[model samples]
Target: MTLTQDAAAAEAAAHPRRESVYRPGHPVDIRRTVGMLRRGPGDPTMVFDGAVIWRTVRTSRGAATLALRAVGDEIRASAWGAGADEALETVPALCGAHDDPSGFDPSHHPLIAEVARRSPGIRLARTNEVFDALACAILEQKVTGLEAFRAWRLLVTKFGHRAPGPTPRPMYAAPTASEWHRIPSWDWHRAGVQPPQSKTIVRTAARADSLARAFRAATTGDDRDRVLTSLPGIGVWTSAETRLRALGDPDAVSVGDYHLAHEVGHALTGHRTDDDGMLELLAPWAGHRQRVIRLIFASGVSEPRRGPRLTPADHRRH
Candidate 1:
């Protein structure tokens, strides 16, 4: 089957593209902010080239290609495709304009305080697109970053709609929920996605519409987590990830992450800890736990690996 580049090209030709200039009061590092959305160095949905970023989104309106660049204190944004207008409208939030750090006092911990002082440009970005964030999170479940990123690259390149713009490189928007559901089992295998992860994606995609609405309507991060984890395959880690990415929930701490607890513990107390210990350690930050965790990651402090890196499982071989 041919790629959907033709359809997006035709649609772009028929519509007037949208553009906006967003002036975030603070020094906004566009790459550091939106780079959270990128799955890997070779992610098909996001490209960071120098000071500019090109991203393709499967928006509620439709597929869109957004180009964002930081100029002086203003962020210049341009969007192409049916969803261009919507994408342009959300540029400010996407650049972390809505992330308020007023209540986040870094004085609770010396390490956190130092990191916060040094990394003033770090802000939690919100996509406001639930399914895309959820799907990406699900793909990462129980897998190494290498495996997850490769699966994302292969799947999006093969099944996703071609991005509608002059991207730095060929890019594509993540497939819609229905399209994700329709991706064949063999295709998932070929992409190195395990059966469990692939099944979870398909099952979630089947109810993406209602789930998206539920997640959007939920007022608190806990409520959203309840709605997300109610699904059979989704758990605390996936829910927290989705909330962080989709809603920019400041307090969403990934409880079940394999290395997060150890990393947080090492960064905070100079040793390793379990998930429970991590929770207790992060409890001081409570409402801003994820922000603290982000600081820890940005601080370049991680637990030394006791052994060799875990070899990524190649499910295709099985």
Candidate 2:
């Protein structure tokens, strides 16, 4: 490397870590915001210390790790690594600081109203990390949570970098899109990522930079969702899932989710419902549909499991 570039990098690295503080208008639940980022118990990119939540994210500039905590009105954050500034800037969004729920006047439904009352701090978080959101959603496509999370843990542990922070636990950043594209087929097979999902990841990675242009061009959350859906293998469920995290579109609903419809149906109408029924049921909530879904999850009522669970097809055992 040129001496000038080397000096620049050293200077950048020498820059002290940044800290940010924000005051949301309403109560902000740190745990719920962390839950939005967590994939499973063993997610290598996310860790919860007793007081603070640490997250390692792969940003456009580079990888970054942030220690985040919220108490009362103030949200506190400190970040490290190349993308530290970017991460610190986005901390408020990650904590749902910009989420406005005043317009979501609840219907007269007893359960929805009650759940809303019970959970004042529940807000949908937006990370604005599109590639990571899309990749994770693709990982979760058509699989049990166990299978998807295992695959995610395996891939990230193997290919991702150690988080750059003084985190209490070892955390890793999700791999860059280019790194994901370079992973061999055998590695994916070993990670329990089947062909369909793996192919989608590779294709998306190839066009990941181009997809960012669409996001930049989008003026509304709906437009951003459509831009994501334009990619092959990115359907309604995946797009909704990605937007819920990447854009925090309150209206985004995972329409084709295997269990979401049933749970929503049971909660709303006292019976199980399909995708169409769930959409119809959620129509009234329009702009705040995902917020309503979050409330339902907060309500602690889900449809009873009746069918056989999806068994993991461990290709490594083949």
Best by TM-score: 1
In the range 227-294, model 1's lDDT, one tens digit per residue, is: 99999999989999999999888899988898999999999999999999999999888788889988
TM-score computed on alpha carbons, candidate 2: 0.90
* Local error of candidate 2 at residue 13 (angstroms): 9.6
* Model 2: residue 107 alpha-carbon error in angstroms: 2.8
lDDT of 1: 0.89
The residue ranges of model 2 lying beyond 4 angstroms of the native Cα positions read 1-17, 220-222, 307-309
Worst 10 contiguous positions by lDDT, candidate 1: 1-10
Please, what are the lDDT tens digits per residue for candidate 2 over residues 1-318? 899668646645775578888887778887886567799989999988888888997766777889888766898889888788888888888888667787796664789999888888888788877888899999999888998999999999889987776768778998988999999999999888888999999999999888966875786767876888888888888888887888777888898898999999999999999999998999888888899898899899988878787687776676
- Looking at model 2, report the run of 10 residues with the lowest lDDT sum: 7-16
